[model samples]
Target: MTLNTRIEAAIDGALGRATAGSVPPKLAAALYHAVKPGGARIRPTISLSVALACGDDRPALADAAASAIELIHCASLVHDDMPCFDDAAIRRGKPSVHAKYGEALALLAGDSLIVLGFDVLGVAALENPARAGRLVGEMARFTGMPHGICAGQGWESEATIDLATYHRAKTGALFTAATRMGALAAGEDPEPWTELGARIGEAFQVADDLLDALQPEAVTGKPAGQDARLARPSAVTELGVAGAIKRLEDILSGAIASIPACPGEAMLAEMVRATAARLTPAHTATAAE
Candidate 1:
């Protein structure tokens, strides 16, 4: 099967299993709604790409890692769009979970997805017990305390925020998990892939900042002007529009260069370039300038 299909199927299967047992009807439906018709599927794709590059001997483990990363991402989006946060009405080009279901159900769905992420990994562990521990540890480190996405969100609540730390945690963390977990799933040394993931994550965030600044909600599929609205730190705000674009290009360049030698190096580089192009905000900054 194609990479996208594999990722979606894995996610669907995981969600199905998690909700099949005694979950409340509304909560279970919300969980499915939160993840369906996923946007980009970038994290899981990256995980699978890295795994393929490094000899994906265990497809099931790689799929589980990818799905787990995406579940966390979707859960974060649901919470981020709540009334307490962005209060966005749309997500993935449709009504957000909080909009369709009540705020309570949306919150519960996000919480459920978080637990399900680890559960997916647990199921994958059955095949190879040794790698399971490391894979789960890497994901948790990126998903929780210290320098995880939670820390990234916490920075927003503080009087002042560190841009690098915030960006790394909120966005770069999952990319790091994607690469490292992909390597771990393939029985390869994950350390070498770390910088590549970090660079890619940083690039993606910068690109997102540009999109938030330059694109409309219709095109971006989420609220525009969020950083400005929320008084959140953004690369485009910190660096000017042109400067953020330059930074994105620089980071993507570094990401491509940082790819550790693997059989699929050329293909991976192409994928990064294509993703960079796709991620560039619809309008050139000159127009906004």
Candidate 2:
């Protein structure tokens, strides 16, 4: 099957289990809403791509890794858009869970998705215990504590902030998780893949900052100027528009260089370049001058 098809299928089965019969109606629906119409699916795409590059011997395990990574991403977005966080009214250009359902249901939906992420991995364990176990550990590490997206969010609450730490956790952690888990699932040493994930994550973070700074809600499909409004540090705030774009280019260049030696190494590099091109701010016509 194609990469996107594999990803969506895995996600569909996982979400169906979570939202299936005997579940609370609204929250179940909210869970579905939070995950559907997935935007870009970049993290999982990277994970699955790396798996393919590494010779995906076991498609089930690789698909599980991709789906689980995506579930975590959806959970993060649900929490990030809540009133306590970004208070975003729209996500992927539609009403956010909390906006449509309620804060309580949104919170529950997010939490459920987080747990379901591990569940997907657990199911894969029946087929390949060793690799599935490794994937679970990797996802857990990046989903919580000092170096994950949670840490990324925690940094925002600090009296002091480190830009790199903030961006890495807030943005790069999942990308890191994506790369590592994909390798682990493919029965390859995951360590060699970390740099590529980090580079891609950092590039994505910079690109997001640029879009938030330059694009409008109509263009970005989410709130804009949040970094400035929330007093949060960002690439644009640090480097300015042109500087941030230059920084994005530099990071993507490094990302291309960081791909590990694999059968699909050239293909992976091309994907990174495609991602970089996709990441260019839509307002570039105005921002680039």
Candidate 3:
């Protein structure tokens, strides 16, 4: 099956199970809305790609891992767009969950997806309990606590922030999980793939900074200049547009070299290049300038 197809099918299957029995109907629907029409599916794609590179001996496990990573990402977005956070009205070019549904439902939906993310890993646990267990632990480590996305968000409220730590936790955490989880899912040593994921995640954050700084809502499908408006630190804020763009180039520059040796190593490197192009905001700074 195609990569996108695999990711979607895995996601659909998980959601189907959640909505199948008696449940809060609105929240169930909100869960679907939050994830469907995925934005790039970057995390899952990396998960699957790393799995493929590692032979994907257990396809079901790999699929579950990818879907789980994506579910976590969707959950993060749902919470991020709530009134307490970015209060973004639009996500993936449509109303965010809290905007379309009520705040209570949106909050519930995000929490549900986070639980579902861990639940998704159960699909292959019986097949390889050891690998599945490792996947769960690794995912948890990156999704919460001192070094996860939660910590990333928590840093925002601090009196002072370490920009690098903030970016690494806020964004790099998941990409790191994506690569490691993919390798773990496929029964490979995940350690070697760490640098590639970190670099890609950092590059993505830089690109997102550029997007938020320079693109219009119409161009980016979400509120722009949020970094400036919210006083959130960003690449564009730290190092002007040109400097941020150059930094993006610098981050992506070493990504290929970081890929661990594997059969699909060349393919993974190519994917990073393509991702870099896509990361470039639609509205070029020069065009706006």
Per TM-score, the best of the predicted structures is 2
**Pairs of residues clashing in candidate 3:** none
Better model by lDDT, 1 or 3? 3
Please provide, for model 3 over 56-94, each residue's C-alpha lDDT reduced to its tens digit, 9 standing for 90 to 100. Answer: 999999999999999999999999999999999999899
> By descending TM-score, how would the candidates be arranged?
2, 3, 1
**Candidate 2 — number of clashing residue pairs?**
0
Q: Taking the tens digit of each residue's C-alpha lDDT, what string does model 2 give over 1-289? A: 8889999999999998887778788888999899998999999999999999999999999999999999999999999999988999999999999999999999999999999999999999998999999998999899899799999998877898887888888899999999999999999999999999999999998888888888889888998888889877778888888898889889999988889889999989988988887889456636866
TM-scores, all models, native as reference: 0.96, 0.98, 0.97
lDDT of 1 by residue, 37-76 (tens): 8999999999999999988999999999999999999999
Cand. 1 Cα-lDDT: 0.90
- Please list the Cα RMSD from the true structure of every candidate, rounded to 1 decimal place: 1.4, 1.0, 1.2
State the TM-score for model 3: 0.97
User: Would you list the C-alpha lDDT of every candidate in the order shown?
Assistant: 0.90, 0.92, 0.91
